[model samples]
Target: MSGSFRGEVRKLLLHPYPKRARDQNPSREGFPIRPPLNNEPRTADEEFASDTLRRMNEVLARIQELEDALDDPSQIWPRLRGAWKRAEDEADPRMSEIVRQAREISPVLKDLEKRIRRVLRRTRELTPLDRVQEMDRASMLWLSRQPGRTIAERAGPAQRILSTVRYENFDTLENRVFHSYVRLAALVAREWQREHRQAHGSDRFRLVDTLRLRCRAIACDLEALGVGLAEPGTTPNYVLMQDRGYRTVRQNWVRLLRRERILDDLWAWQAQTWTDFAVLAIVLAIDELDEARPIAQSPIVWRQEAFKGRWFDQDRPLAVFWLEETGRIVEVQARPEQPGPLLTLARAHVSLRVTDPTRTELPRRIAVWTPHAMQRMDIQVGGEDAASRLSEIGQVASGEIMRDGLILTPAQGDPQHLVASRGKAHVDVIALDASGVSLALGMEALREFIRRDIWR
Candidate 1:
């Protein structure tokens, strides 16, 4: 019976309209009646099949309407309203029941909408990229809906931010600000280094002091923009503690500075400056530390660890350590152990100290020693002129040197001979090499070397 019903449905689907009049009228006048073609509708069964198919189609359409109403209960309101109006007009018996069902379902629909809104809000907060994508989709949908309006007139902030012209402007501004900071910092550091060198003699010039001056200068610049540093009593401190203005500006700056594009630019600029070496080193070190244990998990504890037993908390880990008599910077990672004394006896993974400044002539011979291996690798610095040779060496080393150490990989030599030089900034590396040499590379040459070789 089910199979027969399915066959009837298939026949109806295959030929929805009535058969041709000629095909249905198989018998001609005064002639013997002829049987219908196998594929043609038979006149005897045509009327009954068409009537059944019509009823079946009506039932299927009604079922689809009910399914749609169930899928979105909002559709039920209009349907119920129409049904109630029809019942009133026709004086139907189900009018009261229909009203009761609608009243019960309305609140459920409202609650579902509320829950959907809440979930969407949370999703937007948790996944910013999703929010951006959604915003773009919404803009496109809106544009399609209102074909009369131009995109510029209807575009949201997200759309504006994504626009080619606007994004290019934003990129340009970011680069300008970043380069400005680097240029200002380098200028200040150069002036301070010149004064210090003049006062204490070139041999006694301290990189840490020069760095402090540079940081103070940068902090001053930031303060001018009404963004306070993490430190207190530095500059004018325009951003008051716990002030809403400060919070707003600080949050904006944090978001801007945290962007990869901005940070990468800042890093490239820092690499170009000799005095900014400590700042770069500190940032890199903190980044390494944070990777070991995420700073977000315990920011307060991380701050304490970062600034423990140092000069100003601002320069604690890098510059402050360089100021010490030993000129050493040690970063430790403790093992799970038994006794307190055993913990004390454990050594740091990175233990670096500055050595005495060595004097060298115009074709200077510089050797670097790896801490573990204690093997020296000689670097060849030679050119047409002393200035060119120093420039060549600085180019080779460049941003590789840090406050704690310089990273060296000797070409065609033993890996053991590769070493780090402590308490020397990239500029210090150039200066130390050029100390006794006449017509040596100046600070500008070293800066150019870093800009050309390292930042590139």
Candidate 2:
């Protein structure tokens, strides 16, 4: 239920990057970043690394059910993966090479962009200063109290300077930061231009070209403003630590890189082909059932085993929720057909059915809930009636499952329209929302108790 419509479309690059909780997604070229709370929003044309691809995939998946009527749906990511597989089978290598080439240079581009930003911010906050040795009137007056005098200040001020003036001077970059900044910008600009040139299409890596031009423009702008590109100092810049603005921005910049944790809240949906409305229906059913209090006023009990295998590995999926409603215990699991450890607390803890992602049909993705008895013996853990339930478990090594015609999934059409006339029959249609489907399941599951003769 957790991983539904699990598509086999992970496009890996030559270099492996960590898929951490907050992924930078440096591989996705031209992916528009949905802003994190700590970061500034992206400009419409500017491209930077973020979870744009993942969010786009999520949005496309959500709208797949709505647009199911459309034929030849090749634009979505899941569909694209299928298309890629077909191409691979046909021995077509050009498309894959062209697309993945961008991934190779993206990490470099991202790091370059971050460095440029850091240098620019530090340059602004450092605010270059100059030391001017001068003998101004104010300096002379102050010097008169220095107990010097004795013709210390003669005409034309024969000495070097009466005093040295240490003041904030943006007038000349030959002083500290700006001149070195322009040189740094120019160095990065040349490298960026080289990277842009290596990229094939005119439009493909235009963002890199844009960044390259920006770097060049920064150097040109500073030179135009009467600042020479003087030699850079290798000395450590402790001034940045003192600047509150720089300190705050640096902290936020780090946080901004890692803050946006959710990939589902798409700013706007895009294309992808992954269908799992059945999974949603099952999950929604679980939520609906959990919220309702049983008529018998019995509390729900839950049990689970930790998952410790790699992705797509043969792992056990089990979560037991005991509902004592109408004197019955229901256990829910993704793998209900397989032989597993027995349920212990009481008898007949029914589990809602779930299956592997390879099964594309709705019935295979999920099954209607049936209040049947669980397996016995090695499958039976404990309980007073364990002896009786074992005999009913059949001569099978695995468990058994069934369906009761309950509204486990919602009908098609608007939820508002479906609400008024939903009481008529055991209706079936393509559902538009999960909430309506969930409500239907909650009510219908309760009704199944009285309709069945086994409990009587």
User: Model 1 over residues 293-341: C-alpha lDDT tens digits?
Assistant: 2122101111111111111122112221121322222231211122121
What is the TM-score of candidate 1? 0.15
lDDT of 1 at 14: 14
RMSD to native for every prediction? 41.3, 19.5
Candidate that scores best on lDDT: 2
Q: Which 10 consecutive residues of model 1 have the lowest summed lDDT?
A: 297-306
lDDT of 2 by residue, 396-451 (tens): 23343222212222222122111111122121222222222332443344333222
Q: Which ten residues in a row have the lowest lDDT in candidate 2?
A: 305-314
Residue 142 C-alpha lDDT in model 2:
51
**Whole-model lDDT per candidate:** 0.26, 0.30
Best-matching candidate per TM-score: 2
lDDT of 1 at 145: 62
What TM-score would each prediction reach against the true structure?
0.15, 0.27
Off by over 4 Å in 1: 1-261, 267-456
lDDT of 1 at 139: 40
